[model samples]
Target: MVEPNFSSGRAAERPDAAVGSAPLAEPAAGAAIDPSKEPEGRKETKHLSRSRLIWRRYWRSAGGKIGLVGLAVILLLALIGPSLALWDYWVVDDNAFLSMPSGDHWFGTNQGGFDVFAMTVEGLRKSLVIGFAVAAIVEILAALIGASAAYFGKKVGMVLQWITDLLLVVPSFLIIAIISQHTAGSKSSTWLLIILLAAFSWMISARVIRAMTLSLVNLDYVTAAKFMSVPSLVVIVKHVIPNVASYLIIDFTLGVVGAIMSETTLSFFGFGVQKPETSLGTLLGDGMASATTSPWIFLFPAGVLVVLLLCVNFVGDALRDAIDPSSKSGGAA
Candidate 1:
């Protein structure tokens, strides 16, 4: 203090006294820094799984949001509408025959005096069940057959391809009609119909999946798995299937619509879900006879079917867009 430590002060004041250590200059007042604009080395990294990313993109789209809401409403109605109905679907009320929409009969009455509302709800439930069952079965078959053929790529592949080609060439509608007719009166006709629809429906999806799998089989991860001696089935299930899951999801959704349409067409022609077990097809078939005289009968079921298919197709389209990186509708991550 006596000498004011002039040497030390001078040393501290020297510009390069600390060598590489330099004081960081404070940013100018009110000058905010954007973290997102930081250099690559300083930028924060975010990791999202494939499914989460798909969902994020899907929900961000207007069509996806609308379709999801519509589908949910339809499902909710199918599940709970029956419980809220005033009359039983099977219990005939002769007094209410050919009734118009009233507080008691929300959707009016059929010629048989059954509650149209109750029947519609029941039919919706059955149709949804059949559609989902068929779609799930078809997707499973497509994935298994496609992945196996692509992964094996030899006699096994050829045999599977041959089967797929043969099935594709066969008149699926005729075969399904014939088989369903025989099983229509059986107790498990619904299950039988699901199986029949699934069997014929998978060929196209299988071919598409096969083509995708072929490309994936030569990828680095697949090659690594092969080098590791991982089982073929394991690789197909764990690695191959996941890579092409977006396509499978879209196909499954479309499959549900196709199955429902097929079932409806079969029922309309008297080859599908027979009496005692109602379906949308059965409802539509019965309604078609006196559609002009009793418009409600035809209009309600037909309207529901149209809406259901539209919702499903919309959802499928949105999912496709969301999953495809090249789609403009997918927007940002």
Candidate 2:
């Protein structure tokens, strides 16, 4: 079994150090003694009490509170808004669409006569689903690529890294557009779009992770694990990932938020989700056309989209900060 490498203050004393003519002798049981075992005579420090540490650390900063509140609001909206979206996303109902904001219609209506609020809620669901799927795929792909490169460095790793670098220079939108157009808008196209985006996006993350893994691989603890004959995969999974998980989580959130926004932008520009099937992007696009005459169409959908994106970014930042040792200040009392 692996043991923690954390240093304890205590250390064994050396016999060579003598005081005056008499040598130091071991103390009797229950007598006062030095905390450290080493000749340095350092005392061992006690771990902080959990409750005391928690109390000491509670008031970190104002930003954390704001982040928490924003996260909660987004979560509540995600859950409640979708649950209350009863009507068909595409269905045109006069009362539902183009109606002014009131108790009956919280977000007012759209040109197609569909409830803007319901459609927005439904759109959020779709956006979130796509975002999560894209992020997960990207993170997994990146982690694997990074691990492969770092663990087995050679021509293969160099070539792969080079390819990733090359891809990074290209405009992502153009490539995705070309691919989407070639597929002819089938159901497969959407999934393919997601996969392609994720594949391309993973390169940067993989490179970052590779750098981190490379540094960690040389550490004594990691070398010891290797010496212990642990399987490479297990070691990577258990030791490597846990150490870098904070970066991965933050990277994933950033990727997902970007993917969702990119999807929305593409759809808005008519290179994305086709007519009839609506996403937040589609709603925003339609809203823009008649926006001058009926600003509600644009305002409601765009507002929600902005809020959703901002919320995601905020939460992502919070998590990153919370996990980062530098940002964390107080220990829990």
Candidate 3:
């Protein structure tokens, strides 16, 4: 205590020492942050909109990539395939009856001398059209009926629910089969078939939509819209349906597959898609008789149908996983 501390005194007197000992100044309000020094999980981030986020997750999925590519290729084939064929689907090649695949007649000719390639392309196009049409109708009907039922509960809800329940228990396939058979000869039979398929297919989906709407109708935004004197239809369409759009999208994908299968079944049994207009099912039915004698007829159309259905299933699975935050199959967002 009696002796002076030279080092301590020097340290106190030294400007460099004082500088070293002083606390660091705070960063300016608008200074650029050094990314390297940022703490984990505190780095600057960009926000993603719901659509973008869903697309990001879906694109990251292996199934989604495969499905999308496969679908695109199939669509391309459907659009331009007929032009590539040597003969029209219904045109008979008198000389090349029941022939195997060749340079002139790719995919061979059936018993009727019709080009297999051309028939397959036509069938694919028709099936796709019907599938998309039916799916659209089903989604629209389900959304409107289900959302309306949930929003206007009590008498209207009960009636809608009753209708849904009735449809659920009814033999839809039998009803559709009977109706399609009766209308098979009409000029608008194809459209009629699509409508029939859509009518029966939406019941289960409507129930699901109703359940979703019940949860959504009381949300703050929905309530606000209602209080603002917005029309009921406008509120349901703008607010309620959008909230359930993910499910609707997934349902639409699956619905396409189902509609195609249904149409195929009906056509195979001669109840749907009458002659002069062919479908995959009709081709399969015609080919079944010659399967053993000529496998090409059965194989080509069968292959296309399998591929289309598989792609649809993959897309549906990917969509479901992408939409569900709890699902891990879509990988990290």
Candidate 4:
């Protein structure tokens, strides 16, 4: 330093020696930076699960909302209409036979003097019960058979496929009619009808489920689960079915309609829900005979039936569109 070292002089004269830290350019005037804000492209949003997303899309659709409302009204009627009736469904007023809609009998009386309003509500409840029962049983059977066949493949798959094919070709209506005719008056008739409907209904759905399961079976996650020593049943229950749940749900909805129609047809033909135990079908059958004479008998129940089916179809369509990402009809608003 005393000798005026050149390196020290150079360092002292350097710009870096004059400043304690590197300088950064100041932002332009009025261009403030906020740490709380993120770039639009990098902004994060909350994630929703598949079911919640589907539900959101479904409720947003006009048809879905209408359908849901209609169904709720129908269900409310089915549940409470009987209790509100002035007379019980079984109560017959000989003087009120075929009476027109009056304050005493809101929906009038049938030929047998049974309260049409009460009977109609009872029939709706029974029909709904049968439809739900058949649909649930069919779906369970289809899921089990279809998933098992796809997962096992080989001989097991072939046998199941053959059975399914055979059943598909069989005349389900005729077979059901015949079986139901024989079991008509039995104590277990309702259960028998449910089983028969489920038995025939499952074959078609099983085939569809099998195809879907086959596609899922070879997926990486499924394969990984298998490799990790997970049980086949567990993998199928946990992975396979969940992946195909959308299809199952739609199928179940349609199945309910189908089952209800089937029961109605059979009952109309005297092969289901035998006498004394009325269903919508039985009411319909009775109404047809005197339709022209007493239009109320046919009009009210038929109206309810039409409404039920329409609502169900609407709901099913909405569900299909909502659950399927490829669908454009029920896109989020």
Candidate 5:
């Protein structure tokens, strides 16, 4: 409220002493409105977010865009190319396999007459299948074994870790060589080799899980969980697995690549996949023998395998950067 002295005419008429009446003052212009003074109906304006946000920042980064696009294109090819094969190129002698890269037979046929292109597509699928399977098995088994050892600690942990290290250091090729060849006459040869590979391959994942579990075991949440008398399995799953999942994911990708390479090396040495069922490595081996005369056989299969491996590896690298602490600051942004 404003107060004004009105001591002139009105006051005189009222028989009070005649003085002066003062006019009310106006507020200064361009004054800021206080938040407390604002009316209930009026709303403040807000800035908008930028439009088309998905590719905005991505388009600016050359490496990231290249890697991402390459990965996408390669994955699509790996997925769709094999399924849409022009002919059944994976098995046996066919006229198409002998044919050169043309509209009719895409990639030329092998000496025995299997289409290189078709074989390549099928090979990619098979390789991916085995790779993923091995990765999953290794990561899960290793994580379980590793966490248990680390949590238990002492001699048990030391002995298991030692065994893990022993397996980890052995050349994958040499180990695969000995096992695959020795187990060649088994009832289920390919399955046996895959199992053997899985058996020996958990070391790295074990190491990763152990390191993570070691840290988690000392955490306050874990301590509290223990105090609450929670089931060990439940606590491990609820607390430990979630924290280590990112590591498992990254390692799984790598494990896939390793599995592919291991399978290839074994096949090339004439120990894996056998004669009737062919893999990219088997195809490469066949092509290698005739490479001097029939370069297409080796060329296409090898090329596809190389591309597949490269794409998988790049993606794995990017994922690792995205997840791993040491690599996150330089992650695929």
Candidate 6:
């Protein structure tokens, strides 16, 4: 007991030394640390998702803002304007044939005695449907064929390339004109035109997608998926297409403009959306002769078409800038 009292006296003498000592010099190498148990003074960093980043960039663009707002207004007009119109698009107002804008005929009448207001809205609706439908079909076809070609190179890629080249050289406009003229007699000419437009339009987009896929096919995830025995279709769908989706989105927006222009051009030449069911093209064609005499007919539809195309172009440009890493057109993210 006396010896133990000496040891306790020595320990009591070093009490201040223990209190003065530094904490452990370092954590053991590779020691596990729970992030949740981190000190209160430390702060964790957060990251934005890819979609949010792209959206932020898009919203920052002046063109994107204008395009979004304009497109919404146009869509609203197309949907709700018909309900508020004084006269139906197809109804014959013999008494007010080609009349000027008035309380009764707000946007006036065409030679067919149809309301300009009603016809404009209806045409806008049809153009939107055709434009969107064609763009969707083109993108689907381009994605599948292009991704497949690139992933399964060799004979398949060569054949696809050949076909694409052939289509490029072929007179798509003339062929479309011929087919559309023949189909004009049918009630589904508008739908057929969409198919025709999609068929030719996809070749260019497909080639671009194929080029993109070639670059992506050998990437780490793609190679790993192959090593893991993933189905080729699944690999293409899950990996390749998503990588190229940004380009596809840009192409799709531009495709809408192309499709609309194609429809309008065909209709102008008397090969598109036939009688009974009108479109912006048909309105423009009808108004061209009386452009000076009845400026309202030509001016209203033309203005709408111009505005629609401008908005689409704006959105497309913004999307391209936002998605491209090298593009400085989109201001700081």
> What does candidate 4's lDDT look like per residue over 154-246, in tens digits?
899999999999998999889888888887677888998999889899998898999888988999999999999999989989999988888
State in Å the error of residue 16, model 6. Answer: 32
lDDT of 2 by residue, 227-261 (tens): 99999888778777777787898898798788898
**Higher-scoring candidate on TM-score, 1 or 6:** 1
lDDT per residue as tens, model 6, 1-333: 445455444446566546445543456899998888789778576688888889988998999999989999999998898899988888989899889999999889988788999999999999999999999999999999999999997899999999988998999899998888777657788888888889998998999999989989989999999999999999999999999899999999999999999999888778888887789999999999999999999999999999999999999999999998789987776
Query: What's the C-alpha lDDT at position 327 in model 1?
Result: 93
Residue by residue across 1-333, what tens digits does model 1's lDDT show?
465545555446676666456554657999999888788998766899988999998888887788889999999999889788888789998798899889988889999999988999899998999999999999999999999999987899999999999998889888878888777667999998888888889999999999889988899999999999999889999999998888999998999899999989888888889888899999999999889998899889899999999899989999999899999898888
lDDT of 2 at 43: 48
Give the local distance difference test score of model 2.
0.73
Give the count of colliding residue pairs in each prediction: 0, 17, 0, 0, 7, 0
Position 120, candidate 5: lDDT: 79
Which lDDT tens digits does candidate 5 get at residues 27-84? 6798776886678677575543422222343344455456667767756777888667
Candidate 4 achieves a global lDDT of 0.89
lDDT of 3 by residue, 1-333 (tens): 597656655455665566346544669999998998989798868899988889999999898999999999999999999888889998999999999999988899998899999999999999999999999999999999999999997899999999989988898778878888777767888999998889889998998999998989999999999899999999999999999998999999999999999999999999889887899999999999999999999999999999999999999999999999999987777
Residue 169 error for model 2, in Å? Answer: 2.8
The total number of steric clashes, by the backbone 3 Å criterion, in model 3 comes to: 0
> Which one wins by TM-score: 4 or 6?
4
| Each model's Cα RMSD | 7.2, 11.9, 4.1, 8.1, 9.7, 7.8
Candidate 6 has its poorest 10 consecutive residues by lDDT at 2-11
State every prediction's TM-score relative to the real structure.
0.86, 0.74, 0.89, 0.86, 0.73, 0.85
Which stretches in model 4 have alpha-carbon errors above 4 Å? Answer: 1-43
| Ranked candidates (TM-score, high to low) | 3, 4, 1, 6, 2, 5
Output the better candidate (2/4) by TM-score. Answer: 4
